[model samples]
Target chain A: MDLATCLKKMELVGVLAFATVDSDGAPQIRNISAIHYESDAIYFFTARGKNFCRELLEDGRVQILCYTKYKEMIRMSAKAYAVPEEEQAKWRDIIFEEQPYLANVYPGDTRSIGIIFCIDRAEVEYFNLGVNPIFRDTYTLGGGTITKKGYNITEKCIGCGKCRTKCPQRCIEEGKPYRILQNHCLHCGNCYENCPVKAIVRE
Target chain B: MDLATCLKKMELVGVLAFATVDSDGAPQIRNISAIHYESDAIYFFTARGKNFCRELLEDGRVQILCYTKYKEMIRMSAKAYAVPEEEQAKWRDIIFEEQPYLANVYPGDTRSIGIIFCIDRAEVEYFNLGVNPIFRDTYTLGGGTITKKGYNITEKCIGCGKCRTKCPQRCIEEGKPYRILQNHCLHCGNCYENCPVKAIVRE
Candidate 1:
């Protein structure tokens, strides 16, 4: 599908997934209920003095996951920082509409009521759940679009099954020599990078 | 809902989100397609040699985002590391079932496959999205039937809007006293922890 088509579908039924770091440098994930998607940025809210809030201020890197009800998912990696007062005032109404209660709270607090992410780069992957025989056939006939990207299993695998366990698609099989179920693989490349032996290679 | 009911509801409907650090010490977000709930840990797959894989290997500190298709969302902070090889071999069949093509793949090749992430500690936040007034009322009325935890905003907020932009809920509002929209809040605490002034206080 085209970008506009994908975006429209996402806007209609998209769900936002978030991942952030804690004060101790551990990762955290949550679902966002309200997200303001701007051409250049996105915005959301949280309480004052949270660990994640501190992580962002100390380091502005962030990742956003947006998926459609139908399974299409998009991942965005960006730098996040606080919005200045002048900018916050301009977007106050837009922010309030999405979150009405904000109008009542945060009247005299010293804490910031908002945060923004300025996207530097984004990687989008679109998938259709139902069968699309036509596209499959075309790709098949087209000699299977060469994905120069392939995984290399190094000597460091250590025969560990951690890859098998963590695979969202269950594509890794543990045996004499670990095997990867390519057809079922989403190419997220978790296995390649996580191997203790550096067995899996993506090139 | 009980664990069984919650698991059933999440069968084909769970969203997995996570964060990892780059070489520069900045955090990045990534999404997992499927999450396997084992006895005491959660598993998902990615290529073996990616940045996240490297980050996890070097520092097992990680966080997770798991939600039930919108009915409930949970954020977890945990430590993760690779599993052992002998154990991995035992689960080979189950992994193969999920990825049938593994049979055709090589096992001993250095650039083949491996496992990652065995969660150690975790915190869960349950968000109930039931439309029925009964479910909502029960929780709202303090019936204790629906369970959830609350957080407090600290006195460290410096009025920075970083949390607002990074929030998935758009619950933060920027004003003189900056405030948060608790009604729609998901309690992800992106704003609270990311605030420059450490304003967000989690109770």
Candidate 2:
């Protein structure tokens, strides 16, 4: 539904998937629950000795995904980096406190083997299949901005009020060359398919 | 759990993930639910125009993974290929009959927009974190073979029975050179780590 709702879904779906590319260029994925979330960032912990740790260290590019039982998927594609050395312990303490089961894997002080990584910027796709005509939307988090997407009306627009009447959201603005509001556009391509002049540019 | 149970888990999961490498070498994943499974193979359908479809078509290498609510993960890595034309209709009819919801996405004849793919040979990993000390095992299906994994005992035959006592699975066979049953060995490294003679050859 929204970024906040997606974040809540991630928490409920413990053992989210974290995927990386191995040295052989094959995709590798693992289930991880040692994760703590921020409003606009995600933090996770992994053992220093594991191959997962090596992959993250060598290439910080990673994608984290969580799919809920309600048939909703939230995926974040971001470049991850180690948490600032000065604050690793502070964050690690919070994660351990929240996910007490992690203590079973790394008992007591042995958790020192854990390293913290943060994903603070990325494009996010939230897809919900629980409803008909499955809806999907994109959001940018942290410092990331939503790239220009959806359809744009070019100068060829005759402004015959065709798109304005057909738009589901009815957010289209009337002008010599009508513009569709990027944030509110459903991107269903209804206007593009119906445009008489073929004026809409799909970005 | 066993490989049979793992397959059941994948079916119960419904929305499993299949990932492939992009041209940039980044791993891309999508939630897929149109999959049909046989004892040693898996089949699925996707629209021809999707990024997931293109990735699978271009690179046949893929990893299909499903995580259960009980903290179990099943992943199969293999080379996927387009289902032969002769069998596509048979498989498509079966999938459509079983998953009526698919008809909502592509009504009746519109289903023709889909294409079938199958993965018949794969190295499978089953991991369950619900149990103490955790449990994991590998299964090779179809043409796949269990690779030369686990440690081997060389000619250095002290025969102190240290490995025999240390093996978790007790899969080590006693002889002049204590040999490990590669098929049953967990590759846990307990024997290799404890052997004083260090005769274990790790591959």
Chain B of candidate 1 versus the native chain B: what TM-score? 0.53
| Candidate 1 overall lDDT versus native | 0.52
Name the weakest run of 10 consecutive residues (lDDT summed) in model 1 chain B. Answer: B133-142
For model 2, the interface Cα RMSD in angstroms equals 5.3
Model 2, C-alpha of A44: deviation from truth (Å): 0.4
For model 1 chain A, where is the 10-residue window of minimal lDDT? Answer: A133-142
Q: What tens digits encode model 1's per-residue C-alpha lDDT throughout A1-203?
A: 64445445545654566666655565655555445655434565544334456666776556566666554555544556666757764554566576654544433342244554333234333444322211111111112132233355555577888777655556677775688755455455666556666677776
State TM-scores per candidate: 0.57, 0.77
lDDT tens digits by residue: candidate 2, A1-203: 77777787888887777888877888877778889988888899886545677679888778778887777788888888998889999999999999988777555565665789998898888876676546678878876666454688999999897877666556579998998876555455667767899998776
Which number leads on DockQ?
A: 2
Per-residue lDDT of A127 in model 1: 42
